[model samples]
Target: MDTYLMNERPSYTAYRERFLAAVQRHQGRVSHYEHPLKGRDGETLYTDVAEIGNPDATKWLIIISGTHGVEGYYGSMCQTLYLQGLDLHSLDADTGLLFIHLINPWGTSWLRRVNEDNVDLNRNFIDFTRPLQHNDEYDNIASVFNREAIEPEQRRINEQLWHDRAAEIGETSLRSQITAGQHQDPEGIFYAGQFATWSNQTLRTIFANLPKSCKQAICMDLHTGAGDFGHPMLMAITDHDYPGLEAAKKLFGPWLYTVHTAMGNTSDTGVSASVDGYTSQMLINAMHDKDFMQLVIECGTYSPSMLEHSLRFEHLHYLEGNDPGGHQEPGHSLKSALLEHFFPHDQQWREIAWVRTRQIFDQALVYLRDGQTHY
Candidate 1:
């Protein structure tokens, strides 16, 4: 087994243990922010932040894992792998690395894609001072997600609604509309939540406490379950172009896909473009005074259709008062499928995800250490 893959575990508790051990092995400065919840195994949960090199470094490379909790395994492995191979003495004096592990620890522990409140942390980062972003179109398809049964008739009705909607608006647009994030329905999938979730607040607090000398940083939010199988897509997703966007463009050149999200916008990159309050944008807003480029490494595993099916079934399983990690029949089956969708059991896919993610981190590190920023 590779040293980095040590962090890849069957359960969140094991993964977190491996992560903390790796951090200690590397002598990285660690801070534990406890989550007010327990894991599926009744283990305590936390979002652990580790900093390597000078804490006051002006240039930083921040890599975040587990923004979408079920996807944390991939991110955790990437992080642990990087740490295992990282040489603290060889790092640039002015550059530091920060790893935020399992921001939504509850979801990771429970094998869920959302946080404790069923809030999609990615979509929960919006400004609560103003009115929440409304997805009127999501209401039209809410019934598909609201169903609590996986019976043949129930599944058929839901699938037929999706099919009909796709026929009416095209599959691409249908996907965009369905995933754009909605605030109206707490029970719906991709629920943005009425306010900042614990993960959201915790992330903000982490950003708020960055060393004052930190002026420029390249942040990567690790994710999975979109795009072509075994492919890791590098993306700069934001509502508008920021100072760091051009620098990223030059650094990554054609390798980076720039996504400017807005209402009714679409992208071939397999990410929702119509959504607001993305974590990437939140990072931009948080570090407005600094030159920051927020990037996402979304690894592909299974098709969107497959993902939707898994998500809906698992959601129903959850609604039916069954734990995803439960040993029972339907719950166990649903959990397995959902887990496979986000974090595939396929070995080749896992290898590709880690290799590609490592490459992305390497490039960002080199740029942070030596490359110039537009700011």
Candidate 2:
């Protein structure tokens, strides 16, 4: 396990240093929101906000990472690389850039997909006052997902149950139910929190404190570990078609795919269409007065068919094993294949992801540079 992760993401301190240094090169200032907990190596953690250009800029481009925690390994690299490559002098007066690094610092530090409370940060952005959203299909599959122990026999049972359900409802529908998220069982995988989490509150505060005059925004929440390996898919993901969908379509032309999420919905993008409380939706709802394009750059890692079982094993290890206390020691030992599921070690994979992501950023910056964007 130790050897496999030797080439994994940089340490949190290293990541922070690299990002901060890159921002300094541009003479940018970072508003650091320090996390309450320390990292696996007993390192300080923070979600640093690097805002570039005019604070009162009407056009804003914001890039965020670490929504799923462990996936931040990849997301952080992208953020650092992008910042280092950005030419701050090119920005117009009305458009600026914001990089929100490591939204769920605790999750990244401990190498877990969920936050410190086992909540999927992406799924924790919903309103707690309203009745929680339900997935009847998730309720039916509770026996499989909510298992306390994942023994060989238990693994077999879970597999057979998955096959049965896949045959009954079709594989795509089954996948939708599994990833749509639920709040009923805290121990279960993809569990949304029962209330607002610290990270959730922090992000909301970041938005609320932003310059109120800003009208148009492009908020991208980056992710990995889905779809074809090494492919970075550009998607506009939301619970419904928001106002900026057309703007996104026009901006990216054939490079973009629009995903309208709903219960029992279908998509080839490998993003969950049935999931609610996505960061994108929350940003849109919170700043409804402005034209906001809530986007996602989902760089594909390993296939979900292989990753689901691997992640479940890790989940059980996290649930049953001793906590790593925000230290570098992960709850579950890392395997090469599992590591690739989030951070592929292949140089080609890294290059492709960077090249594609940079291309998209180039387009986005141009849109911000010019008042209008065209293919």
Candidate 3:
């Protein structure tokens, strides 16, 4: 199938075509589940799940991509390339594979992190039984997201305020307050949806339809815009014990890092608060009766400041619209720079990304098929 043909990095439209084409080519063994888009475009973005091996296989390797929309470019590419070259005929009677592509198509098309509703899908999976939780800390920072221009004084004030809060409430508290999922302000950052989003509902449906024959499931959700440049870090999101963490570290060696508590070097205070309804959590909640494990593979692109600047400008451009002049203006450039920062065009970075992803996938497959944890 020349999987590399699926490797050509293209714009949103081209990527969609290549993905659909790949599914068509493998339609004999794969079933496509189409979700009609609710937006005005009337375009239906497909989330294709490909199953191979026995229907009743006890062990399943589930690879999912594009939970964050913009991050799907790398994730979709990995899944497509894998399927393009995968030999379905070589089946392990006890094992199965499920490939879920583009969980959030709107974000992918618009190249944004959130869905059409500005909901961070990762933060959208909360228990509705509770009074819709709000990140009060985020409320204090609402001015940071104000549509006004980023004045030099405002930037200085923000920096000083951040440090002051870090000292007073602690960094973890601050991070938890901000990043912890909130439902009050839909327009604000990391806003967990008031209700299940389309993607959220779709994912629940997908989990329900998972083959009953599968006793164990392994999931890897691809993400970028974190960690070191070009280096893919396999991060653990589950609150599982040391054994599960050790098993993963042993399987992937130094390539993996465990983030059980929000206290490590990579730990930020509000991260836990903002990540209330992560896909990982949803999977765990759905598969409580089954043995399930998952990993979030985050590839770093830019520094904290750069990422913040990029996201801020992108948000500004979307909310304020482009200047009358053109994309060459500062606002447009900021958005462009953010995209490039996360999705670097450099050959070396791309090659490294592909190689590392393949390594992780191959290693995960071996772990799944063997049914043995080696540390």
How many steric clashes between backbone atoms does each model show?
0, 4, 11
Whole-model Cα lDDT of every candidate shown, in order: 0.84, 0.78, 0.68
lDDT leaderboard ranking:
1, 2, 3
Which portions of model 1 miss their true places by more than 4 Å? Answer: 1-9, 148-152, 304-308, 372-375
Lowest lDDT block of 10, candidate 1:
1-10
Q: Which lDDT tens digits does candidate 1 get at residues 255-291?
A: 8999999989998888999888899998988888888
Which residue segments of model 2 deviate by more than 4 Å?
A: 1-9, 306-308, 323-332, 335-337
Candidate 1, residue 56: lDDT: 83
For residues 1-375, write the lDDT of model 3, one tens digit per residue.
344433454455666566666655655245555655532134566776777666788888888888888788788777766666666665466878787878888777666778877888988886877887656677666656544434646655665656666788876667666766578776666778888888888888888888878778878889887767877777777544534455676677766666653322235311352356778766766776776677787877776652165766676566565451114577546645655766776667766777778777777777887766451
- Among residues 3 or more apart in sequence or in different chains, the pairs in candidate 2 whose N, CA or C atoms overlap within 3 Å are 39-326, 40-326, 40-327, 40-328
- TM-score, cand. 2 vs. native: 0.91
User: lDDT: which is higher, 2 or 3?
Assistant: 2
The lowest-lDDT stretch of 10 consecutive residues in candidate 3 is 262-271
Candidate 3 residue 136 C-alpha distance from true site, Å: 2.4
Q: Mind giving the per-residue lDDT tens digits that candidate 2 earns over 186-275?
A: 888889889999899999989997767688888888888877888899988877676688888888888798888887787887888888
**Native-to-model Cα distance after best TM-score fit, residue 311 in candidate 1, in Å:** 1.0
